[model samples]
Target chain A: MKYWGTLLLLPSLLFAQPEFFGYFESEASTMQLGSTNYNFGFNKFRLDVEARPNDHVQIGANINIQQYWGKTSWDVYDFIPVDHPTGQGLIFTIPDTILLDNFYMKLSFKLADLTVGRQQVSPGVGYAWNPVDIFNSKSLMDPSYEQPGVNALRVDIPLGDRSTVSSIILPKDVLDESTHQFTLKSGIGSFDLTATAAYESEKDWQTPLLGRYDVSERNLIGGSVIGEMLGWGVWVEGAYNTLKIDIPPWSSFLPPDSEETYAEYVVGIDHTFDNSLYMLVEYLHNELGVKKQENLSLNHYIFALEGEVNSLMQDYTFFYAMHPTFDYVTLSAIVFSNLNDTSGVFSPIIDWNVYEDTNLSFQGSLNWGDSDTEFGLQDWGLIMNITSTF
Target chain B: MKLKLLLLSPFLLLIAHAQGPTADQIVDRVTNIMSPENSHSKGSQTIITSSGKERVFEFESWAAEKGKSTLTRYTKPAAIRGQAFLMLNNADDIWSYFPRTKRIRKLASHAKKQKMQGSDFTYEDMGGGDVFQKKFKSRILTEETRDGAPTWKIEMSGIPEEDPPYPKIIMWVRQSDYYPIALDYYNEKDFNTKSLVLSDIQLIEEYPTAMEMVMTDNKERSSTTMRTLEITYAWEPPKGFFSERNLKK
Candidate 1:
C-alpha cells in the first residue's frame, strides 16, 4: 500500500495532476468477551490512485494495509494464523499488511464505458457481494469491504439521455474451481433493474463447501428496481442462489434437511424535503431455512431510517433491524462532517449537503441476539469520523 | 460637502419631527439602500471557520442600480459546476432561477425563511426588502443608540402579527449613514432571543458599507459570524466569470 501511494505521488512530480485519494481509519473497542471485557484496536491505512492520460482512457487502483492487533480464539487462529505463540496471548496480530483492493483500466468512448481487470463489484445494493470480487472479499463475519474474487470485465452502454445498459463477466479462478459469472443492469429515468447469474465448480470465497454444505457447484440470480414518486422514491430488490453440495462421508455431522437453495429480498422508501432534508426507510428479509420448515424459516430482517438536515451541518440517520422470531434489534446511525468541503464519496455517504455537512458526528450500532439457538447474537459498535475534501 | 449637508438637513429634520417613516417608507429605503449602484464591488470568497469547514461562494452586487446576479458552487471534484442561486431583481419584480437535476425549478415566496447553506441566515435575509413590503407593518418608536451610535428605534410586526421566525426586530441605524449598526430579533414570546451586530462600516464613495456582521442566538449556543474581508466597486470584472460557460465549467 505504501509503495502504491509513493508511485501515485511520483505523478505529482510529472504532470502534477496526481489524482490520489485515500483514507486512514482506526478503531478501538472493548468487547464483553463472555464474562471478561477485552480491549482491541483495528487500524487500516489505505491509498487509492487514479490516472487519466487522455479523455478516452483511465486507470485506477486501491491498496489497503490493515492490522488486527487483538486477541483471538483458537478457531480464529487455526483459520488465519495470528503472529503469536501457542497459548491465548494479549496480542494476536495479522502481519500480512498489503492487500490489493481494486485495480482496473477503464476506456470511455463518448457515452459508452468498458473496464477490465480485478475490481470490486457493488451489486443489487447488497453492500458487499463477492460474486465478482474474487481476489479478496469481505470476511463473511464482518461485511465492510470486498476484494475482486474473480477477474472480470464490465461494459456500460448509454441507451439515451436518461437510460443505460450495463453488464459484467468473470472467468474461472483457482478458488472457485469453475468458470463464468455474469451480471446485467439497466436504468431509465428514476427506475433501475438488474439481474445476475453465475456457475461455480468448487467452494467460492463467498460461500462454504464443507460437510453437507461443501458445495462444489452453485448458481445464483438477482434483480432490483428503484424509482421516484410523488415527492418520494421507492426501491425493490431480490436475489436467489442454488447450491449443489458434495455428499461427504461424514454426512451424519450435518443436518439432514440442509437446503440447496436460498433467497432474499428487500424493499425501501425515500422522500426529500425540498433539497435540504430527506428521509429513507428500508426493510430486508432473508430466507434462512426452507428445506427444514419447522426448524428455521425466516432468517433476519432490517429496518432503517436516514435523513439530512442541511448543507453545512445537522445531518443525522438511525436504523433498526429486527429478528421477530428471536426478539432482537440492530440499531445503527449515519453521520457526516459538516466542517468539510462537500466532495468525494464520503460526502454523499454522510449526506452533508442535505443539511450541514460540516457537523462532526458519531454513529453507533448495537445488535441483540438470542443465546439459546444462535438466533439472536448481540454486538455493538460506535464510530467517529472526520472528513475534508479538496 | 457643507452645501450638500445643509440642503439635506432640513428634509431629514422634517422627517424626524414627523416621527419616522411608515412601514412602506422603511421598505422603500431598504430596497434603495441595497441597489447595485450603492454597493462597492463584486467578488467571490471561500468561507472557512475556525473548525476547518469551508464553502466557496460568489456574488455580483451593485449599489444603486439593478443588474444581473449569479451564485455558483463546486459540488463535486469532476462534475460540472452548478448555480447555487441566480436572481434578477429589478424595479418591477424579483425573479430567481434554480437548476434542476433533470430540468429547472422556480422558487416561490414561502421558501425565503429557510436557511441559506444551512446557516442561521435565511434566503429571506438575502431577499432584503422584497418580502418586507407585503409581509410586515412598521412604525418608528424612538431615537436610540446602538454601540454608541445614534439610531432610529422601529417596531415591525408581520401583517397578521402572528408568530414569525422572529416576531419583531429592533434595528439601530447610524444617523449619518442610515445603515443599520445593530439589531435585536425577538421571538413570539417577546424575548430578545437573537441579535445581529454589524461593524467596520467604511464609506465607499459616500456610502456606508458593512464589512462584517455576527448573528448570535442567545437561547442556543450557536452563532454565525460573517466577515467580508475585501470589497471592489468596479463595474467591469474580469471577463467570463459570470458567463454560463464558466458556471458549467
Candidate 2:
C-alpha cells in the first residue's frame, strides 16, 4: 500500500544523519502438552529512528519485522480473527509482513507537551501487575516484551516541581463519548502517587455454542502508590469498576440483576543483596476471577475469553529472582502461582553478555498441577534467543 | 648586586628541594585536590577484556560537602541509561536506582569489595575522600624519579583493626605538586593484584587534576580506561539533591 511505501522511506528522508538503533533476535522454542508437542522458530528485526529537527519538535518511529514458521498441535487461527490478525490492539500482523510498533511526533511548549500518533502510554507503578494500566494490558507470561502502542493524542501539563496531569484521547471510526482517560500523578514526601479514571464501552461476549451477548458500559477508577520502606521498595495498585450488562431472554438461569461492581489489587516488594542477588514478591487479587472450579461455568469462561477477567483463580502470587553468578553472566527465575488451585508455572532464564552489544539467553518453563487446575493443561516449554543490538 | 643575586639563586633552589612536604602532608594535599568542596564532572569509561573487546559507558557525576555526598548517573548505552547511584554522608550505605523497574535498592556493605560496573575499579575505589588517612598508616619509603619527575614513594599499610579491601598500597606522589601519579595495591597474600596510573595532568579551577586514568587487574589481565570530558568546581548543588527522594528522578 502507499502507506507502507511511505513508512519505509520516511526515516531515511527525514534526516540526512539520524540516530538509528535497534536489535535483531532469533528464537527457537518447543512446547510439550500431554501427548502433543509444538515447535516454533522466530526471527525478529526491529529498527528505531529519532530525529529532532529543532528545539520545539521531535519525531520517532519503531518498525518491526518478524517471521515465524512452525507446527502446532492446536489451531492458532481459531484464537485470532481475520479482522484482528495480530491478536493485540497495538500491533498489525499480516501473514508474512512487517508491523509498525510505534510512530509519534512530540511538541514541546512553554506550559505543556503534546504527543500524537501511535505510542505506548503505560502509567502504573506495579512490577508484576498494573490494574490501572487500561490503555495497554500486558501479558504476564512474557513480561519483557515491548508493549504495543495505541493510536491516540496525549497532552501532559506540569502542575509543579513534582506533579503532573496527563490526558489521552483515543478515537475510533465513529465518534463516541467513552474513549478518554485522565490521570494525575504527584510525589509527596517519599511516596509517589497516581490516580486515574476512564470510560469503556460494552462489547459482545462470544461463545462456541451460544452466539453472542451484549455487555453493558463500564466506568473505571484506580490509584497507585510507590515508596521505599526501611531498605525495601514497596508498591500497591488497585482498580474498581462499575459495570451493567443485560442477559439474553432465553437465559433465565442467570442472575436477575444486570448491574455489577468489582475490584482488583496488587501489593509487591523488592530487594537486592550485596552479592548482586535481586528478589521480588507480589500478591494479586482479582475480584472478577472465579474462586473455585464449581463456580466456573460457560458464562464465566466466556467472560475470561473476552478479557473481562485475568484468570480463573482469584488469588495469585508472583516471585522473581536475579543473580549475577559471573562477570558477564546472570541467572534469573520467575514463578507465577494460583494460590487457590496451588498450581503454577516456573520459569528459569540464563542470560550471557557475550559481547558489548550481543546477548544470548536460554529460558525454560515447567507447569505443574492436574488437568483441571490452572497451568495444568500444558506440560513444559523451552526457548533460546540470540540478540544483537546497535 | 648582580654577583650576589647570582650566587643566591642556587642556594634558593637547594632550599626549595630540601623543604619538600612529608608523606602525611603530601597525602592530605592530594586528597584535598582530588575531592573539592563541590564539584561536577562528565566522563567516559571503557572496559577492555582480556581478549581485547571493549565496552564504553558515559556518566555524569556530582559531589558536595567535599565528597561527603555524591551521585553518579549513567547517560549512555541505552540499556543502562537513567541508572543512578547515590552515596550519603551519614552512613556507608550506597543506593542504586534501576530505571527499568523504577526502584531504588540499597547495596550491602560487602559490596565495596566487588568490581564496579564490571570494571577493574571496585566500589571502594570510587568512594574517594579522606578515607586513606583514617584507615591506613603512611610513611615515606624513598625518593625516586618516575616518568622523569622526582617523586616521593609512600607506602601505606592498613590499620590492624580496619579490615580494608587491600593490605597495603604503594603510591608515587609527585614532589613538585604533591599529586599521586601511580598506585599499587597488594592483597593480604602480599600479591600485587591491582595497579592504577593517572596521566594527562591539567589545571582545572586552578588545581592540578588528572584527566585520564587507567586501572589494571593483574590477576584477570584486564584494564579499564577512564577519561574526564569536562569538569567544574566550587558550585554547590541544590539542597536535598542527594537524598533518596531524588533517586527516582
Candidate 3:
C-alpha cells in the first residue's frame, strides 16, 4: 500500500518543473536473417529528469516506456517468472514492463566529482569499434546511438585544464566478483591522449548443448590518441588482454588449456572537404579472430553472441561518407567489410529536418556474399523512424 | 550660420580623414567592444530555409580572456539537448561532447570553417575572438554615412598562409560606436555570397550588446537570425569550469 501511494505521487513531480524533457519516437523495421523473414516495430516514450535540490548535489534519471506492435499480448512468465527470486523482485513487483535507463546522483566538489548508481561509462576514440570498453555493447547499424547504463561508483579528479583521472567500480554479489577500471586523460600539444586499465569478467556457452562451458576473467590495458596530421583527423586505439580458456572435449581443433594474450586494435582517419563532403575510414584487427573461413566454427559464433568479441574475422574495415544534399536533407552511406571473408554490409541513410524538434529518417542495410560468410548470414534490413520532442 | 552648417553636414561626412584613425585602429576598437572581459549569454538561433521553414535552437554560452576560450551548450531541440562544444585558442583546439553516445570527440583545427548545426554561422563565427584580425589585413576604402550617421567602409583581404574561411570581407563600421553594423562575405571565387545585418543594440553593464543579428545567403534567399534573450558581463566562471570533465558532465 505504501509503495502504491508513492507511485501515485510520481505525477506530482511536474509541480516542481526541474528541467523535465524528452521525446516520443515511433519506428518500423524489417529484417531477413538467413531464410527467416521478420517484421517488428515499436513506439517508445523517453522522459528525462534532472533536479538540484541543494547546492552540491544533483540527481537525474532517464525513464522509458515502450510498447511493441503485433505483440500486444504477452505471457506473465516473461517478466515475472515463477522460478528463482531475487531481493529486488521480492521488494518491488511491477505489473507492466518499465525500463529505467539512467538513475544516478552526482556530488560536485572544488577539486573532484563523485557519482553513484546506474550510469554510463564510455571510454574510447574509435567510431565503430572500442577495444577497451566492456560496460556496454554498440550497435553497428546505429553506431552513434545512446548507451545503456550500468550500476557503479565513479570518482573523477581533475589534474589540470584538460587532464583528468577517473576511477569506476562496478560491484556484484561479492568484492571478488566486481569490475574496476582506472583511466587517465590529458591533452598534449593539440592531441588528446587516454590510457586505461581494467579487470572485467567474461564467460562463454558452448553450442549443440546449451551449457555453461567456459567461465573466466580478463585483464586489459589499453590507450587511445587523437590528433591532426596533414590536415586530417586521425586516431589509434588498441588493447592487450590476458585470459585463461578451457577447451571442450568435443572441440578437436581447439587448443589445449592455456593462458594466452591477444590484442584488439583500430586505426582511423577522417577529413571533411571544403565542399562539405565528409569522409572517414577505419581498420580493426582482432588477434583472437578466426584467420581462415574454414576455421570458422559454432564456438566463434557463440563467442560473438556472448559479447566475448565483436567480430569473428581477423581483419575488418569500415568506411563512411556524409553530405548535405539539400538545405534540410542530408545523405550518408556506410560500408562494414570483413576482409578475411570478403563479405560486407552496405547501408544508406537519409535524414530530413522536417520542423522544429521533429525529424524523419530512413536507413537501409544490404548484405553481400554467401551464407558461409559472416555478414552474409543476414540478408537485408530497413528501418524508418519518426521522432518529435517537447 | 546654423542653417549653413546643418546643410553642409552630409558633405563634411564624406571628407576623408587626415592623420586620423587608420583601418587597423578602427578594427581593434570593434574587436575590443565585441569581446568583453567576461560574459555569460543565453540566446536562440532561428534558421529559415529557402522554402520558408524555420528551425530554432536555444543555447547558453560562456567566454573569457577576450574570446580566447569559449563553451556553448544547447538546451533546446531535444535532438541535441545535452550537446556541448568547447574551443580554445580561437578554435585551434576544439572538443565536442555527445550525451547520447557518452563520448568526447576532438575535431581538427581546420574544421572551424564547417557550418555549425546547419546554420549560417560557422564554428569560426562562434569562436568569439579576434580571429579575423589575426588572419586578414584591413584597410579603409571610403568614408560614408548610413541613415545620417557617420560610418567607415573597410575592406579586408585574407592572408594566404592563414587559410581564412572567406577570401574577402567588407564591413560598414558605425562611427558613434566601434561596431560593425553591416558586413558582406566573399567566397573562394571572390563573389559576394552572404551579407550580415546587425540591429537591436543596447547598453548593458557598460558593454555594448547587439540583441539581434541576421545573416542572409544572397543567392539562396535563406537566412539565420540570432537573438539574445539574456546576457551579463559581470558573471565569472569558477576555476576549471571549462575543463573536459565539466564538459562531459
Candidate 4:
C-alpha cells in the first residue's frame, strides 16, 4: 500500500515532461544442486522515470516488480525475518515483491553537484569483481548484472580540469551508525588514478545466533589505477580494511572479541583483437577467504550469499570472451575458476538482438570437478531470457 | 634587412612549392570554412542493409571550440536511448555515458577505429576536425570534373606516428567553396574498402554545410545515410558546458 501511494505521488514530483521508459525481462532455468533437481523461473518488470526541471536540477526514480514460480515452500530453519519470531513447524513461501529500487534528486551548482537518494555508489575498475566494493555481493552466474543501489547523499566537486573529489554518506540509524566515504579521482595523461577512504558501521549484521545481530565496524582505505599500455587496457583495484567482530554468547569456541585486518585486490587486463574478438582476464586475492574446500563453513557461505562478503575462496581467476557472429548476434562466455579448490564453472551465452527494441539470450553453464570442490558443489543450469524495452 | 626577409619567407615558401594553393592550405581553408566556434545539430541516421532493411536512429549533438570538443546523445530506438558520447582535449580523449550503468567511462584511443552503433561512421569520421591534417600528409593529384563541377583531386597518406585506420585516402573537393564532396578509403592492400559522399550542400550562416551524407561499404554492399533536420552555429553553450558534469546530464 505504501509503494502504491508512492507510485500515485510520483507524477506530482516530476514537474516537467518526464522521460519514462523501462524494460521487461523473464528467465527460466533448470539445474541440479546436490542430490536434488530444481527447476524455477522469474519475471521482472522495471519502470524508470526521470525529469529535468531545469539545467541545474534533475529527479529520477526506478520502480520494480519481481516474482518467482516453482517450489517455493520453506520451513522455519530456512530463515525468519528479524522482526518476526518463529515457532515449531512454521513454514512459509516466497512472496512476490514490489519495491522502489532507487530514486535520486540532484542539484548542480557552480562548484559541485549535490545528489541525495538511493544511488549506485560503487568504486572499482575491475570487470569481474570489485574488491573495494564490500556492500554488494557478486553472482558468478551473471557477474555483469545490475547492482542494487545504496541510500546515500553524495557531493561531487571538481578539483581541476580532469580531477574530482566525491564525498558520500550512507545513514543507517543514528549519526554514529552511518557509513562515510571519500574518493579523489584524477587523470594523468592516459591513466586514471583514484584513492578512497571509508568508515562504515553495519547495524544488523548477523552473528552466530539467529534473529540477533551486533554492530559491526569496518574501516577501509583503497586505491585503483586504470590505464592503457601497448594498446591493451589494464587496471588494478585493491582495499585494506580493519575488521572487529564480537563473539556471541551461544558460541562454544570462546575466542572472546576478535580484531583483525584483511585485504582484497583484483588485477585485470582486456584487449580487442584485430578480428574483433574481445577478451578480458582478471585475478582476485582475498586475505580472509577460505584456504581449503574442507574449511568452508555454512556461516561463511551465508555471509557470501548475503552482502557481507563477495567471495568464499582465497584466489579466483575470471576470464571472459565475446565475439560478434553477425551484426545483430553476439556470442560470449565467462569462466570463474577457484584456484585453491581447483574447481571452476563456465557459462556460454548467445545474445540475439531481434531488431532494435528486443533481445533474446540463452546461457548454458557447466559445473566441473569433484563434488568436494567449491564450484563443483554448485548448480549446472541452462537458461533462456527474453527482454523488451519501451 | 632581416625583417624583410623574415616577412617574405612565407610567400617565398608558397611560391617555391605551388602549382596552385598547397594541399595543406586547401585542407586548412576547408576545415576553417566548415567548422565554427559553436554549433548544434539534430539529425537522424538511417542504416540500410544489403537486403533492403532499414533502421533509423535520432540524435542531437553540440560542439564547441571549432569542432575540437563535442557531445552527442542518442534519443531514439528505445534500447539505446539516453546513451551519450563526449570528446575533449582537442578530440584526443573520449568518454561514454550509459544510462543503464549510470557511470561514465573513458574509452581507449584505439576505439576510434570501430564502427559506431553498427553504422558506417567511425569515431574518427565523426570527430577530429583538425586532427586530419595533423595525422596525415596530403598532396594534390589532379584537377578533375565530378558531379558536373570542377573539383580538386587529392591524396592523403598517414604519418608514421599516428597509425591511422586508413593508410591512404583519395578525396575530391569542390573548387568553388572548397567543400569536400567525396572520399575513398583504401586498405593496406590498396583496395578501396569504404566511400563517403556528401550531397544536399547548403549555405547556412555563411558556411558550406552538408545537410545529407551517405557512407557506403563497397565490399559489404550496405550503407548509412545521415540527414540533418536542424542546425545552427550562432549558439553558445553555458559556461563549463563541456565538462564531465554536463556529459552525465
Candidate 5:
C-alpha cells in the first residue's frame, strides 16, 4: 500500500519540479590536538528539486549523501572509557539511506499564503530559532529537540511596503511521532516582535531550553531594534522563553526542576570606511537558565575587522570571539577571493555553494581551556546542511 | 594692481609648466594605437604572475565601432571567460560584463580609482572611461628609459573631484610607440597604494603593445595581478561573431 502511494506521488512531481541542480565536492583533513593525531576525508553529493505548480502552489525537497573513509581518531568528546564495553563513539542514527530532508506544499492568494507538511518556521533574523533552515549545522555539537515538525501552516498579511504580519502553526504527533510548534510575528522598523509556542511528544528531545524533561513544552518571545545610526549600522535583539520539563534523573545534576524562564540578547554595530574598510563588533548574552539561576548565563563577545584594499584583494577579515563566562576563545580569519569569491575560513570547515538557491556547510571547533583534559571538549563538530528555496 | 600681477605671474608660469597634452591629442593617439582596421597587422604582449607562480597569457583584441572586436586567449581560456573581466567599448552605454555568470551589467559612477573585478586594474584599466570625457591637468615630469626603451613620465590630476576611483594618477608612456609603460595610483588616505608596470613592448602589426603587466598591492599577501601574452589590436572578429542579439544570446 505504501509503495503504491509513493508511485502515485512520483508522476505529479516529475512534471512539477521547478529546476534540477547538482554539486559534488570532496575534502581531506588532518587535525593535530596535543599529542593525538586524527585524519579523515569525505566527499558529498547533493541534488535539489523545486517546483511551482501554479501562481498559488509550490513544493520542494533535498537529498544528500556522504561517506568518510579510513581510521577515525576519536576526540575527547567521542572518547569512551575503555572499561565500558559500549564504546564511546560516533554513531549514524539517520542511516546513509535516502532520507526525506524536506517536503512541503504552499499556497498563496492575494493577501494570504499557507504551507503544510514537514516545514520550518523562522521569524526575524537568526536569534532564538530560524525554523526556515532545516539543515542547520551552525550549532551541531548541541542536540536537537525537534526536526522542524512534519506538518506546518503559515499565514501572512502585507501592510504596505513598510510593514507585515505573519503567523505560523504546526501539529505535534497529529498522525505520527512528531512534535508541534506555532509562531507569530509583526511590526516595522526597529520595533519588530515574534511570539512562539511549541510542544514536543518525545519529551526527551534534546532542546537546551527544555532539555531537563522528556515531554518538553516552551513559549518564546523575541523583539529587535535594528536601524542605521549616523554612518554606522546597528541592531539589538532580546528574547525571553518559558520552558516546562518532565524531569529526568540525569537533569538533577544541577537544577531544581520546575517551569523556568530564560532570556538572551544580542547587540551589534558596524561602520564602513570610504576606503572600503569596515569594522564591526557585537555582544551577546544568553541567560541559559531561569531568572535566579542566571549563573548558567553565557556571555559571548566578538570583534571583527574587514578591509577591501582593491578589486583583486577583495576582503580580509580577522575575527575574535571571547566567551569570558565559559573561559574559551576562538580566533578566525576569513579571506574572500574577490576574483572568484571562493572564501576560506581558518579551522576545519566544509564550505560549499552547492546550487544557485542552496548552500551547505560544516565546520568543527577545537575547544581550548585548562580543564582535566587540557584539550577541553576537543570533539566539537558541525553537521551536514541542506538548504533550498522555491 | 602690480602686486596682484606679481602674485599671478608665478602662478601663470606654474600653470604653463604643468600643461601636458590636450584631451583631443591623447584620444587621437589612443585611437591610433588601438585602431581596429590595422589591428590584424599588430602583435604585442606583457607578463602575468598569480597563485605564487608566473604564467603568460597571449591574446589579441580588435574593436570596431560598427564591426566586431575579438579577443582571443592563447594561454588561459579561463581568464577571459572568467569573472575577472568587464570589457565595455560598444556603441550603447558602456556595459560591464562578468564572465562568471556570463552576464553584462551596466557601469555607474565615475570613480577614477575603482578597482576592476578586485584586480589591481581600475575601471579605466578595462578601457571603459574615456580620457576625453574627463578633464585632466597633466605635468610632464621627465623622459627616461623604461626596460631600456625611451618613456615619457606624465602626472595627471582630475579637475573634477567627484570622478571615478583615483583622484590622482601617474603614468609612463613610451615616447617612441606611445604605449603606456607603467601607471601609479594615489588616493587621499593610503597615499601611493598601488603601481602597475608594463614591459616587453612588441610592435606587432605596427602598434606598440605591452606583452606583460604586473600590479602589486601594498596591503596583503598574494596581492598581485599580471596580464601577459597579449595579441593587441585584432583586424576583425571571425566571420559572424558579433550581433545585437548576440549580446544577450
Candidate 6:
C-alpha cells in the first residue's frame, strides 16, 4: 500500500504543468533451425512526462511496460529467469515486467547544468560499435534500441560556446565512490572530438561461475573523433583498460596474480551517392578477443555470456546500405563479419510509413559459419513490428 | 508669390512618385526586404497529397549575414524532433543533425534535388533568399495585375555555366511594395514543374514580409503550405551559434 501511494503521487510531485507523450509497439518474431521453428510475440507500452516548473528547474520521467511469451529449442533454464514461473512446460515461458527507464531532475545555472537520477550518457562516435561507451553497453543486434539508463549524478560546465566539461558519479551505496567518470568534448574546425576517463573499484566485480578470484581496481581512457575527409564522413574511436586480477591457485598455465591492459579501436567511413543511396564500411580490432577456437574454453565462454567481458572476436568488419525505393518505403541492408573466424550475419530490412506517426518494419537476419565459428550456433531469424507515437 | 510656389511644390512631388524603379533595382530591393542582416522565426508546414492526406511539422529557424548562414531545427513530430540543419555562407556543403544517433552528416551537393521532409518543396527551395539573384539574370516582360495589385511580370534565366536547378523562372513582383507575389519554375525541357504563391503581406520593421507561402509540385499533384507563427527581424544570434557544436546541442 505504501508503494502504491508513492507511485500515485509521483506525477503530481514531478510537474505543475506537464506534457505527456510516448509510444506503443507490437512485434512478432520467428527463428528457423533445420526442420524446427520457434516463435515469440511481445507488446511494449511507454509513457513519458516532462515539465519545466521555472526557468532554472526541469523534471522528466519515462516508464516502460512489457509483456512477452515465447517457446524456443535452446536451453534457457540453466540461467536465472527474469519472469515468474507459473506455466508448466519445457520449452515455453511467459514474462511480464514493468520498469522505470528514466527519472531525473535538471537544474540550470549560468555556467553549468546539474542532473540527478537515472539517465543515459553515450560518448562514442561509432555507428555499429562503440568501444568508448563505458557507462552503458548497447546490443549490436538491434543498434536502434534505446539503451537503459544508469543511476548517477551528472554535472556539465561549458568552457565556451563550442566546448564542455562533464563528470558523472555512480554510487553503489551511501557515501560510496565505487564508479566515476569525466569527459571533455569540443569542436575544432569541422571536427567534433571527445576524451574520457573512468575509475571503478574492485568490489563491484562479480565472481565467475567456474573459479574464485579477486579483482583489483580498474582504470579506463578513451577518445573519439568525427569529421569529414575528401567529401566522405569519417569517424574513429578507441579505448584502453588496465586492471589487475588474482587467479585461483588451482588454475594451471596461469599466473596467480597479474596486471593486464586491453586495447580496442574502430575506424569507419560513409558516403552518399547522387541517387540518394547511403553506404558505410567499418573495421574493429579488439585485443582482448580470442582469435581461434582452441584459445577459447567453456569457462571463458561462460564469462563472456555473463557480460564480464566484451563479447566479440579479434577482428570485425561491418557494411551498411540504405535507399529510399519509393515515396513511402525505404530498403536497407546490414552485414556484420567476424573476420578472425570467417563468420558473419547478413540482415535486410524494409520500412514503410503507413500513416501519420505510424510505421511498419520487416527485418530478417541469416547467419552462416562452421560449427565452432561465431555465427554457426545462431538460428536464422525474422521479425515484424508496428509502432505508433502519440 | 508664396501661394504660387506652394501650388507648384505639389506638382513636383507627383512627378517624383510617377517615375518607377527599373527591373534590376526592383529585384535588388526585393532581395533586401527578404534577406535581413539577422532574423528568427517560428513556423509550421502542412503538406497535402492529392489524395487529401495531410502531415504537419513545426520548426524554429535563425539566420545571419543576410541569409548567407542559416540554421533550422524541427520541434514537432516526435520522430524528427531535435533534428537540425546548418548551412554556411553560400557553401555547397550542408550539415544535418540526427538526435537519435547524435551524429552530424554532411549532405552532398546533389541532395538539393531531393524532397524536404517528404514535402513537395525541394531542398533548393529552402536554401536561402539570395538564390535567385545569385543564379539568374532578370528582365522585365510586361506590367500586369496580380492579386488585385499592379505588378511587373519578369522573366529570369539561369547563367549558362552555373547549371542551376531551374532553367527559367517567371515572377510577378508587386509594384507597391516590390514583394514577389508569385513564381513559376521551369525545367531544362521548358516545362513548368513548380509554382509558389505568397500572400498575407504585413509590415514588420519597416519592411514588407510574407506571412504565408504555398508551393505546388505540378507533376506530383501535391502542395505544401507554410504559415509563420512568430517572426523577429534584426535579432542577430550569438557568434558560433551556427557552428557544428550548436547543431549537436
Model 4 spans with C-alpha error above 4 angstroms: A1-14, A34-36, A72-94, A206-215, A247-258, B1-18
Local distance difference test, per candidate?
0.45, 0.74, 0.80, 0.79, 0.43, 0.75
* Tens digits of per-residue lDDT for model 4, B1-249: 999999999999888767577789888887887678889999999988776667789999999888898999999988889888888755457777777767676766556666677677877688846765777789999999999989999898988688666789898989888999999998888989889999999999988899999999887787999999899999898777776677788
Q: Candidate 6: which stretches are off by over 4 Å?
A: A1-13, A72-95, A173-177, A203-216, A243-260, A299-311, B1-30, B50-52, B68-71, B82-115, B122-124, B129-176, B181-195, B217-221, B234-249
Question: All models, DockQ values?
Answer: 0.04, 0.12, 0.55, 0.41, 0.03, 0.20
lDDT of 4 by residue, A159-206 (tens): 766788998888776878898889899888877888989888764664
Write one digit per residue (lDDT tens) for candidate 2, span A1-390. 526534754764376356777789898999886677878778998887877777667676788898877752234222222222234332222244498877777777767778877776766766667777666555566654567667778888777644668888876555464367788987665566889897665445554334466555667899988766765767889999877776777765456447768898999987766445878888999887878766665455445544556555589999999886665778999999988878789999999988776889999999987766657667899999999876
lDDT of 4: 0.79
Candidate number achieving the greatest DockQ relative to the actual structure: 3
Any residue pairs clashing in model 3, and if so which? none
* lDDT string, candidate 6, A261-304, tens digits: 99988899887764568888889887877777567654445445
Candidate 6 lDDT by residue in tens digits, B1-249:
999989999998788668666677778887887788888999999998766778899999888878878888998888677789887745354678875554565554555556677787766677666767878898899999988999999888988777566899999999887889899998778989889999998998887878999999787788999889999986878756786656755
Give each candidate's interface RMSD in Å: 12.8, 5.9, 1.4, 2.0, 15.2, 3.8
Q: Across residues A1-390, which tens digit of lDDT does each residue of candidate 5 receive?
A: 524523544465688856654445454555544465566666665565667777567665556566665444332223311122234433322223345545566666566556655554433333222322222222222212223323455565544422345555444445343444444444343333445444434434443222433435555566655444543555565556665655666533324344656665556555434443334444445444212211211110000000000111112222322111110111222221111222222334343433333445565555443222212323332334443422
Candidate 6 backbone collisions, by pair:
none
Alpha-carbon deviation at A279 in model 2, angstroms: 1.5
Please report how far candidate 2 places residue B196 from its true position, in Å: 6.1
The TM-score ranking, best first, is 4, 3, 6, 2, 1, 5
Off by over 4 Å in 1: A1-17, A74-96, A126-150, A173-189, A195-203, A206-215, A247-252, A255-259, A272-279, A289-369, A373-390, B1-249
Better of 1 and 6 by DockQ: 6
Residue lDDT tens for model 3, B27-104 = 899889989978999999999989888888999998988888889899888888979988888788889998877788
lDDT of 2 by residue, B127-214 (tens): 7767777778889999999999999999999886765557899999987888899999998888898899999999998888899999
